[model samples]
Target chain A: MKAYDLSIPLGPMHPAFKEPLRVKLKTEGEVVVGAEVDLGYVHRGIEKIMRRRPWQKAVFLAERVCGICSNSHNLTFIETLEKISDVEIPERAKYLRLLAQELNRLHSHILANLALFLAIEHETLAMMLLNVRERVLDCQELLCGNRVILSYNVVGGVRFDTTPSILKEILAVIDEIEPKLRRYAEMFEHGPLLRMRTEGIGYMSKREAELAPAVGPIARGSGVRFDWRMKHPDYVDILDFKPVWREEGDARARYMVRFDEIFECIKMIRYLCENMPKGEIRRRAEVKSGEAVHTQEAPRGDLTYFVRTDSFGRIEDITIRTPTIPNLGAFVKYMLRNSPTIADAVVIYASIDPCIACLER
Target chain B: MAFPKLVKIGLRQLIQGPVTNLFPKTPPVPVPREFRGKPRYDREKCIGCGACVKVCPSGAVELIEDPTIENPKKRKKVEFYMGLCIFCYFCMEACPVDAISYGDEWLLSSYDKFDSKLIVRDLPEREQS
Candidate 1:
């Protein structure tokens, strides 16, 4: 065995990644054979904090798991509380829930793709982030008055209502934004540098994808037809859309899958806008003492929340598993074959939109 | 590659305007009204509710109590530490008094950790009822 000291520390810095997860790569020559990740940097003891707070208040705490995936965490925690007491939210609330989730999916996936471009130092593509992200941010602000952390989802209902005016404004914003989005997607697909860098690189075979336990774009890229949206039909059954998947399992394939998912989300959002059911966005329900499991396919992958409530209105226990945990495994596998540069590792990691804070929680 | 096609790209760069603005050295480009940047805190409107303190996920806000005040509620103070602040703006959402507002001070940097932490007054005496 040839001995070589190849250790590179990625970051705990505020700029490198929003969340803190230090990537320590051991490379033999230019190939990374082994990788270890450290994630204690951003751990705020969210679970422990949740255990101390009331279950109702815990919804707000859980929603802070990550700014990009705020709605998903908000939904998961609320859904767990609803399940524990066997409370059913109103029909209209469910529709709004689906709409918010899909919008979040669109915003998160696009932002992730933009970040991947940023990591590879594609300034032209990276500059597009400001415009593309602004659309979703405007939509989020119009709807909930906040862009990054939308504190809309309450216990049994959402805080904001999709009034006629709000709906019209949302639709108008989407109309203005969609053309720019499509143009960027076209640019991404045909861009020479983008193609050269991402196409057939970081290839994860279907078997390898399944074996690695990655989900969302990582799994869908490998042709694994697994999506929590399909699995849990109750959440998205009424929404008229299908899960986006690709067989290539390369970085470009993952990027394309994300782009296609945005279109699907828009379709679902439009459908919800046109045919929004008439009912209260929230329902009155009692928070009971019991243990319950909550699961939702967040933008990245299956975000699971386990909650146990005490007789008092406070939460007894809370646990979360973010998508980054599984998707990160794919990097060690793929980077082993490539002449891994620091840039390559950064690109591969950014491609998954790894949220280390959520993982540590 | 064709020579004309190659020359066209090269010549265009020579004749074309600069791709990026030279900051500080040249005049700075004006940002839009809605640009997202650093946050601002207002003391007058603040009710000393401490909602901002509780809701800050980053533990960036610290409430300093004046020991000599007759009414402790009226003497509450706050200091913001940008070092730990994530810029999530949860404090703005959680503020009942609407004391905290988002500002355009994004170019924040400091050599010392203590210098980076901003000390903000939570609520002045006149604001208290």
Candidate 2:
């Protein structure tokens, strides 16, 4: 028997990633033996930026943290500030915030699924998913005024309110999207090639997942039934929110978890829109000296934000713990196991859906 | 069965045609009513209060004094650098006289960062109050 060790560096710039992240893999023949991750290529010192900006303007800065889950950052930041000031957001504003967050989740999950398909060379499925995701973006643009960086959440409440026609448009978009998502789910579940590539590839036990203490779909995919949305006070009465989980604990299970969650989000959005309360959309609040820790379920996982404010309403200290940080441990562990092939390694890495911008920032 | 699923999806898409627009060749799609695009400044309505400058998050709005103009009323010029603008519409909200409004034109791309087209100069003398 002969063995050859080859070190290959994948990304910092590669087709597999939308952002820059370097992963050095030590391979023997076609099997990866060791892995080392190199991040900080896309770090912009967002926490430092947040501390420098005025508390009022920092919401926009927070929104700029990650282009995909921009709303989650804003929501977490505002919720932190609101907690410090002890301001109760109006019922209507809560519903509106929930709506925006779920819409963001819809787009983010679809994009993640699109990346998974693309990683496995399913270009047609990737394009079709992108096409379907556009409807969610359109709905977001209609509701929040911007598709990507929705500066919707202000200090005390949401920036804008919706009318009946806008609500109708949103419901109509949801009506169109639900069936497409169902078909996609069917394909993911029944498609042989997809299953061949994804199934039983990146196996993580419930013990490993619990030890990593992973949050979001990654953890749930391994049978850890935990979700921040269900426990969140704002969403408690809005809908019957439940966490989706699968026991397979592979790349396919993770994929299925995200796919099913999209449907869950669709149902949540529909329920919120149907039962939306009519009231003032925003309230004036004063920020005082205090600190708060807030958490919300970002598309990737549970995102947490800690914020401190001075008496004059300036940010004293701000820290953001994005989901990618916790999931990185599980990713490294998965890569180093069983000497998986390069293709399996890529799929596993994509399965964790590493957001370098969020992690390094 | 898996092949049949792909075939069905392909046929459905083939019948429906492409979902993307022929943009640039065709005109761009219309933005929503509240979209914060290019900021339009009404020179006549500006009161030289500099409120927009105070509220701009990116320092995109600047009040440049025209040394050439001796008249105090016509001396203050508002220079809006679209390059620095994040399209947050904070300036529009801060303008007390309704001098700034969000225009629907979002295609502000340029080869040069400081393109002349990127700067909107609201000269006080151009339009009399």
Candidate 3:
């Protein structure tokens, strides 16, 4: 008989993942001993498509890279081009950008935790989290026109400007979502079932996280005090909150970090709503031949965009590096090394917040 | 905190009715007024400069030239294949003469992709506007 008695393949399409990602697990009875991740199921050829289009049209193409964190991709791409062109946006536009991106992070973190709950077989928690996410989405929709795929960021500034009434409504949304998130966090913290399933399961030590070269919450959850947002000058000038991290390096630790992050996002949004500067939202970006690299802390992690344009401001070449490459790649290789049970593996995968569309793009 | 989270949620569901709205059975939750849904066209304002034709990222907006007409001025026309429209409203934004506006129409489902009703076409050029 084989030492590893059986191999079970889980999904290019699975309930635990919203996108297609296949993971093959080699198991000895109920415990998984080894695993292999498979990609390339959802190659949309978006990068190749972006190169054919100029920056103006390509911003929309960038937004399509990930439905969940569309604004991050759009913002990063625009900033890369703008840096080369030396198009400085107004202060109000920077504040508006902060509001939009934080709301984006808020909803995305909630959704990631919702996935974790669903994978752990807690349907009730998942459904409730979906409602909380909808409120955050409404706030996003109020500021920007669309819910999921928003081309809110244009060449010089944002497309939509916020009214006083709009800021008031966003504040109201945060007020409602706060209590619900707090209550749920308390439930998850004290709930024996969640703790039993998540605590000390699928551990990613600080060393493993550094070795994986993980960024954003995945690295934060594993005790690394690294965040790309800290390096972004605009973020430092507008928002004062520090990045949230947890030391446990397990499924529970990862989700706890998300809960804290939701609160931090709420704080930043509130500050922006109160102190939002009033000014013109946009300016014309002149087309220039130059190259620049820009990185934005996306909902999943650090997303980098490198852009080189011709003398006419047409995109000569553009490259995007999404965090899931290092983050999820490490999860499959290091974190999933010795899974105790089938259910634990799913929860662990869900906890890392794998954005496959962004990864494969 | 709710000691048993499930019971607390179940009780709330018992009181607050269903979480989801009755969509398809009823109207969708009203979107904001600035919604760029159901795009409309005004032929009088269209100069046929092809700004929209160039700016449309989806390539949904087309400048359909009337080969049947010999006059170059009257030959050029605009038609919106709404099926291909991503509702990004880039065409409306790119219009130099303000030829397009938001109609606030959400549902665009039809059995035929190129149904005549689905297409927002330019009216014939007023002999000498």
Q: Can you write out model 3's per-residue Cα lDDT over A1-361, one digit (the tens) per residue?
A: 3368788898987887888989888898898888878899999988888885677788888989998888899889888888888889998999998888888888899999998898888998899899889888888777887788767888788887779998998899888889989999998888999999988898989998999887789889999997888888888877865788999898898899889888898999999999998899998778689889998899888999988889876788988999899988778777786468987888889988998888888
Interface RMSD of 1: 4.9
Best by TM-score: 3
The candidates' DockQ values read 0.10, 0.58, 0.54
- Candidate lDDT scores, in order, read 0.75, 0.86, 0.84
TM-score for candidate 1: 0.75
Q: Is candidate 1 or candidate 3 better by DockQ?
A: 3
lDDT by residue (tens digit), candidate 2, B1-129: 569977997799789965668886777788987777777788767778898898888888899887777677877768889889887887876788898876777888998867988887753235333
Stretches of candidate 3 off by over 4 Å are: A1-3, B1-12, B65-75, B122-129
Model 1 C-alpha lDDT per residue in residues A1-361, reported as the tens digit of each score? 5355788777866354656677777777666656777768777888888786776557767888887889999888888888888887778887888878778888888888878887777867777756677778777766665677777777677766667777787788778878888988898999898888787767788988888888887899889998888766564468644677999877888888889888888887888788888878877778889998877789999888888888876888878888888888776665334535555666677777788777777
> In lDDT terms, how accurate is model 1?
0.75
Clashing pairs for model 1 are none
Clash tally for model 2: 0
Candidate 1: DockQ?
Answer: 0.10
Give me the displacement of residue A315 in model 3, in angstroms.
1.7
Per residue, candidate 2 scores C-alpha lDDT tens digits across A137-170 of 9999999888899988888888877897898899
